[model samples]
Target: MSALAPDPRFVSQAPGPGQRSPFLRRLAHASEPWLYSAPALILIVAVMLVPLVLGISYAFRDVRLLNPFSGGYVGLQHFHELARDKAFWGALKNTLWWTGASVFLQFFLGLFLALLLDKPFYGRGIAQALCFLPWAVPSFLSGLNWAWLFNPVVGPLPHWMVSLGLMSQPENILSDPTLAMWGPIIANVWWGIPFFAITLLAALQSIPRDLYEAAAIDGAGGVQRFFSITLPFLAPTIAITVLLRTVWISNFADLIVVMTSGGPANRTQIVASYIFTQAFKKLDFGYASAVALVLLVLLLAYSMLIVLLRQSLLKKG
Candidate 1:
């Protein structure tokens, strides 16, 4: 009798080189994820990487805004100058306060809004739309509106404050250094709150109703359920949002630059405005670039800290 032929259908397939398993083989060739993200990666490289490289190059050289001169081989000069400059330090301090305070307030306010909106009510859609309107407004243009609204002489807010006997005179919020920082923050927060609210609201909606129902069956109240169940699930989202907002607020220059022009004695100038001033106004192109490099480094450090914190939290869970 002839040798029986093996059935191809039941044959053992040899493992391909570099493939851990058949599952990985499918994943290795999968087009869905890469296709979905290819555009974003290309866009980021073009928009983000190009500017980053330019900024870094300019930091090393004296490239004035007007002249755009290539200031060559300054070596630690700009960094040293930044360390000595009071304006830089002041701007940094204000930036930290602005970013921290605004993020904190935005988080709580967003959490409150998200919680409130999670419960269905009349006109909920309209209310949510109105709440998110500030985000839709152009940030720089919002600065203009806010600047006028905070104007000492004519803003309706100050008038109300005066009428309420909070102050005998309409205070120039943008003129006082302490209040000046707050002016930009108020605008930034208004724009930022809707972002958090929307993000958190989505997360809140995704929570299985069964969890809440089970909690209710266990005699846990809304607050209790939130503390135990809701907070735990939302922690990662909140952390990510806070870190993102920190990065954003730290770099936020629009409101301050537009509204106060880093005035009230450079009290409102963040790293962004400071870099702008160094590059444009002072014409210290290389020095400004160095300051920018420092800011970028600091931002990276901050992001690293957040990553560490996230890792620690994950380990705990």
Candidate 2:
């Protein structure tokens, strides 16, 4: 018998330049990012999303840790309780003050430091490192350190204030209900300023030098150049940084828990710490989850407002 002829249908054609096997290649290309990100996505779902959903469920049901049978559905009972919770209202007010003051101070101070660092000088790198050192310290340690520094018996700050006539005598400001919130606020600002500075400095460095040069050549002075060139360029960064820091600081409870534990008549009890207190100390997980849900809603609203405002401003400009 004659040798079987080569089967034309089974013959393969070599892929030319820019050619590829469509189906498999397209699938791999589409799935490549998901494959690389699956681990992180799974971790986030496990750690964050799952807890969030569970907490929302807990908000509507009794989930006290110490109770043997506390998972009964309660509908809007927890929310109704939250509405009348005087302590929760107080904590909400404190959260606003804490977040506003901390973000304002941190942003301005960071901007100042970033501007200073943006310009070359002696020991510039060292100065940047020193300024950023506080951020490197763990949050708990920073809180404790500041708590110590506010202690009248051990710290010199109160004594120095007395010497400068800023106080009647060496007194622990953290013990004063009126001034207690300032303790955590100051610590937060110090620790957070470096973050804003680093972010702003990076944004500042990315600005084209020629814009400043053009502004200067147009008879613009320092202030004019700043207003006309720098401020406009930095506006987006400032808005985003402020928004993020506001939300983060509003939710932060570590410094308050470490420094004062929301003491002094609960004057420093922001919503976050109050939630922690309800959950951990009182073991009222339902109430704590309710409070957290409220906070989450408020934060979502605030973020949306900021984003809309930014978009509007961008359009107007």
Candidate 3:
């Protein structure tokens, strides 16, 4: 009998001399993901990483905008000056107040609105749209609008405040050092509440209706269910949103710049506005970068703390 022909399927299909090596093939396969993400990685490096690095480097140099030849390395001189700078210290204080007040007001109001909108009601869609309208407005426009609203001569808000006995007369609160901070804070809260509302509303909708039903069957009241179930479910979302808003608000300066210009007596001058002042008005880019670096470090520390706390809470849970 003739020997059976070897099965082609079982035969070794070794690479020809012209074919790629196994290692080269594996390498190419491994690099596919990187190739796919190359555009995003490149964009991140160009937009975020490069600017971050340059800003850090600028902190150690004297980079005035007007002076082309002023790029000398100054080490920690800027930081030392920052340490002694009373204005910087004041601005830092204002930053804490501004961030705290705006975040607090925005979060609570947003949560309230979210809770309201979550219920089955008439025209809920329209109500939600109207509530979120302020957020859709550009921040610059919001600032300008709020500025106009607070204008004693042109706007009705000052007159309304006067008639409501909130003010003695029709006066621009933005011009009062004592009350100037509140103008921007109020505007920021108005613009930012929608962010929390949108996020919290989404989180609220994700909650299981069955859980609420179960709680009700177990004789839990509305408040009890909210505290025991709703809050716990929303905790993670709240933590993350609060952290993001805190960071964003800490860096926000548009309203202050457009409305008050950090003026009257620099009462509304947060660190972000201070950075702008140094960078543009003072033309001290190096110092501005140094301030920005400090802010970055502070925000990083804050974020790490929040993350660690959340992790601890999760572990305990």
Candidate 4:
């Protein structure tokens, strides 16, 4: 038999001066994009990669500003301490509550607002603005207002609620252990609604009016039109929004810090604030970093799960 043809590298397979291999040709034909996308790549590396490295560094070394040598290479001691921490578990649970409730409530309420506001009506613009008002307000500043509103007295809101019998005797919403956590959830939900509404409203507007009109002609009612045309089209946006907000709320420690300090007795502690308490309040940097690392792991796991679930559902659909 004739000897096997020489490999392409051994015998140059030059088609022409301008011609190239299929793979190389495709790559050459398409812009390499290194220079064009370099700025974004650098920015992502600088912002995300640097901070992540720092976070991991802090996790390993028991360093504090007071003493750089406060650092000790006590391998997995931090993780062990965090594993034994009651506060960490409590905080993790609260994080779940905040993220789960906030995302759910925000999506539905915002979708409702987007739908109603998308429709023709007098003063619709004003109504939309009002609905979005909470989002316009700064989060910490809004927390203060919510904090005051839930105060037992001195605030009009609780007093008015008592008079309206919506709550009994100027109820201190956050005074109770059970109610404190929900206050932040409620505040976050109110603040978050506009974001979802605005995102979804833009998507909703892009939808053709003809679809609705055609559905109506087919005798589908408002509810039917919504479920069929609106929801299927809007589902992807809703999923994206929920996933983003879930991740966002999962790390939220500010509102809890400002409003309750994780308290009425550590009742409202979340992993973020718990980490804060461990690091600064308790002076356990190594242990705190362990908790932080665990928190990061949980979020990473959840995010991966969500992506996989989304892909699976997309495939099935």
The number of the candidate with the highest TM-score is 3
TM-score for model 3?
0.89
lDDT of 1 at 102: 90
Among these predicted structures, which one has the highest lDDT?
3
- Candidate 4's residue-wise lDDT over 1-317, tens digit each? 11535446634654454544544654555657776888999999999999787777778777665665687676776777767878777878888888888888988898888988998899988888888999889888878888988887666777887889888777777878887888888888888899999999998998899999999999999889989999998887788778877888888777877888888878888888888877777776667777788888878987997888778877876
TM-score list, all predictions:
0.81, 0.88, 0.89, 0.81
What would the per-residue lDDT of candidate 3 be over residues 40-119, giving only the tens digit for each residue? Answer: 99999999999999999999999998999999999999999999998899999999999999999999999999999998
- What C-alpha lDDT do the candidate models reach, one value each? 0.82, 0.90, 0.91, 0.81
Question: Can you give the lDDT of residue 85 in candidate 1?
Answer: 91
Name the TM-score of candidate 2: 0.88
> What TM-score does structure 4 among the candidates reach?
0.81
lDDT of 1 by residue, 184-213 (tens): 888888888999999999989988889999
User: lDDT of candidate 4?
Assistant: 0.81
Report lDDT (Cα) of residue 148, candidate 3.
95
Order candidates by lDDT, high to low.
3, 2, 1, 4
**Candidate 3 overall lDDT versus native:** 0.91
- CA lDDT for candidate 2: 0.90
Clashes of 3: 0
Question: Among all windows of ten consecutive residues in candidate 1, which has the lowest summed lDDT?
Answer: 1-10
lDDT per residue for candidate 2 within 1-317, as digits (tens), equals: 11434345422553355655444455689999999999999999999999999999999999888998889999999999989988899999999999989999999999999999998898999999999999999999999999999998889899999999999989999999999999999999999999999999998998899998888888889998888888889988898778877888899999999999998999999999999999989999998999999999999988888888778877977
